[model samples]
Target: MITITEKEFKQLSEYIKINYGIHLKIEKMALVTGRLHNVLIQAGFKNFTDYYNYVVSDKTGEAVTTLMDKITTNHTFFMREANHFYYFKDNVLPYLTSTVKDKDLRIWCAASSTGEEPYTLAMILDEYFGMNKIWWDTKVLATDISEKVLEIAKNAVYSNERIASLPAHWRAKYFNKINNENSVLIDKIRNEVIYRKFNLMEEVFPFRKTFHTIFCRNVMIYFDNETKIRLVNKLYDHMEYGGYLFIGHSESLNRETTRFKYVMPSVYQKI
Candidate 1:
């Protein structure tokens, strides 16, 4: 196994932080080296420095894309955080139904890794709307920094075990068995999510309209205080007034640094 030297680690860490707002500290050296070792060899690089150089020099941005996919953690499963979904369905949906005059609900899953979180949300929306789904536009915009995960999410296929935690009725309705009992998202549910590759570190968000709800769960744990504050402000700017923001239960927004009104642990509302 190839090891990353101190200088090589600094170079790669700085590059990732500058480009993606992910702060890799010395403690994560093993994590970085372990995840990126195979990537380094497969990309024809003998060492970490050479891999870093190649990633920065590649004008097409594919190298960086691949690098992000390798370094970042995309560990998520269906209904991983079930309480958020329950709150959204029971409280947020009712609020939106009455207040959103346009009847267009724009929800953004900012770190929708491998389709589970966004698809779970979509299924909740489907169940909520039921017979009146045609009267409202409820498609979700699911984005992630890693193209690898985006590709997987777009494919909407998973092992049966991956979806075992989902409700039995939801499992029956939104997914179908394929390739010997592997679950694949049914077309109607899959079509409700639009997956895109997005870098959260971009200085300015390009969306023409604000979102009614945003799920940026568990992704900010890698960012530093400054980066997290700046990103939270950006999200605040792009959210509709009174819109909801759901983050990982372990993540929190500093009351002084963000404009979002704290509603509960891991949940906020645009003021």
Candidate 2:
């Protein structure tokens, strides 16, 4: 495996941080080496600097997309953080239904790693709206930086182990069992989420409609404080007045710097 010199690593690190908002700390050096070893080999790069040059010079985004897929961990599962779902189902849903008079519920899973979180939200919305779902636009906008994971998300297939995190009823109702080891989500549920390749670090949030709920869980862990604060504020601009923000349980907002009202651990409200 090719090794990166300090200078080459710095070049790659700065490029990623500037474009993707990932803070690759010194401890991550070994991870970068291991994760990207095969990429370097397959690209036929003799040295890290050469690989870095090629990645930057590649006009097509495929190079960077591959870089993100390898370096950025997309570790998520259905209902991985169950408590946030409970809060969304019990509290957020009720509030959104009662107040969002147009029934156009705009929800964004800003870090939809492989679609579990957005799909879970879609199922909950289906249950919450039930027969009246036909009257509402509950389509969820799910985005991730890596096109690779977005493809996986669009596939809508999961192993039995990955599917096991969902409720038993969800397993029966929303999925078509493929056999003992895999299942595919029913079209009714699968069609509810729209997947996109989006970078949160983009200066402007592009959607014309502000979201009523944003589930940007776990992804911010890779960002530094300044990046997180900037992204949080940008997200704030794209949310409705009474919108809810659900982050990872391990993450918290800086009360001093953010505009979101504290609701609970990993949950905040835009007042």
Candidate 3:
């Protein structure tokens, strides 16, 4: 395994955050070293600095996106937090439907690594709202800084092992087994989600339409307090009044919970 010097690690971390809004935790040093060393070897670079220069200066600029996808920690599965989904279905949806006069529901899955989280949200929505119901009435916008994961998300295919945690009924309803080894998200459910590339640290969020809910879970644990506050505020800005924001169970609001009153554990509503 290759070792990343402190200097190299700092350089890589800062570059990633500047380009992707992802703060690499110090513990991720091993992860970065393990994942990036092969690419360095493939590029015939002797050290981290050489590889960094090549990545940043590449004409096509695809290397940076590729790097983001590789290094971004994407440890997620369907229904990872069963309670949040339960709350969303039982409490949140009914409330949003009754209060929001538009009758259209929009959700943003910020930092939606790979596709599980956003697609899972789509599955929940489809289960509640008819799959073929008014197309314009419900939509999910899923964005990640990594174009590579976005590609996987668009494919909407997963191994059965990856989906073992999902409810059997949901697995049966939303996914089709392929070749007895893999499963693919049904087109109807997949079509309801829109995937794009977005960086959270951007000065101005470009969303014109507000969301009924936003899922940005498991992402802030890597950020510093200042970055976390900025991200939380930005997410709040794009949410409608009474909108829901779901963070990871292990993460805390770190003094910024004032903007969003805690509704349940790991769940907040933008007040």
Candidate 4:
């Protein structure tokens, strides 16, 4: 493993926090070593300080994006948290039907990686409500910082092991295999999600309308406390009043300034 000195870690932390509002914890050395060692080796750097210096000097954002992509955790799968989807289908969907005219429903999968989360959101919404076939508007905005992952997300292919996280019925209905190595999303579900690259550290969101819900699960654990607060506030702005925010099960918003009332553990409603 490539050992990063304490000083180098702090420098990298400050740089990432300043540029991306992401906090690299001390324990994430494994992540740093696993993901970024190649960047160092390719650059012929013997230590992380050299890599850090190279990154700092490159103002074009490619290196920065690469760094964030490496340091951030992106492990996720379809239906990773079943209850959140259940709550959305049973509770949130009904609310949207009454409140939205033209049957419009928009959801933002803010940390969307490799498409599973947003695609899963689409499947759950369409399966129960049959919205995929409807003429009225309904779509998922899926965004991630990594262009590499976003490309895979745009393709919407997965392995059986990846789709194994999905419900049996959804797995049967929404996915089809091309070969032993991969599966593809059904056209119905794939057409409903829009993928793009987004950086949470940016001051403005590209969305033109507030979303009914935002699934930002498991993404914020990479950020510092202050960064978390700022991100929650920004997400609150993009959410319709009374819309929902579903975070990772392990993450909490106890100190956040966003006016979201706790709906349950790891779930909050914009107020």
The CA lDDT of each predicted structure is 0.92, 0.92, 0.84, 0.83
Off by over 4 Å in 3: 1-3, 25-27, 255-257
Model 2 CA lDDT for position 212: 99
Per-residue lDDT for 101-164 in model 4, tens only? 7667888998898888898888877776763447557789998888878888888889988888
Reference-based TM-score of each model: 0.97, 0.98, 0.92, 0.91
Task: Pull out the clashing pairs in model 4.
Answer: none
Clashing pairs in 2: none
Clashes of 4: 0
Which sections of candidate 1 miss by over 4 Å?
Answer: none
Q: Candidate 1 or 3, higher TM-score?
A: 1
lDDT of 2 by residue, 1-271 (tens): 7888888888999999999999998778888999999998998988889888888889997898899899988899888889999889999989999999999999999999888999999999999889999999999999999989999999999998998878899999999989889899999999999999999999877899999999999989999999999999988999999999999989999888789999998999999
Worst 10 residues of 2 by lDDT: 1-10
Candidates 1 and 4 compared: the better one by TM-score is 1
Runs of candidate 2 exceeding 4 Å displacement: none
Residue 205 in model 4: shift from native, Å? 2.1
lDDT of 3 by residue, 221-265 (tens): 878778888888888888999999999899878544468888877
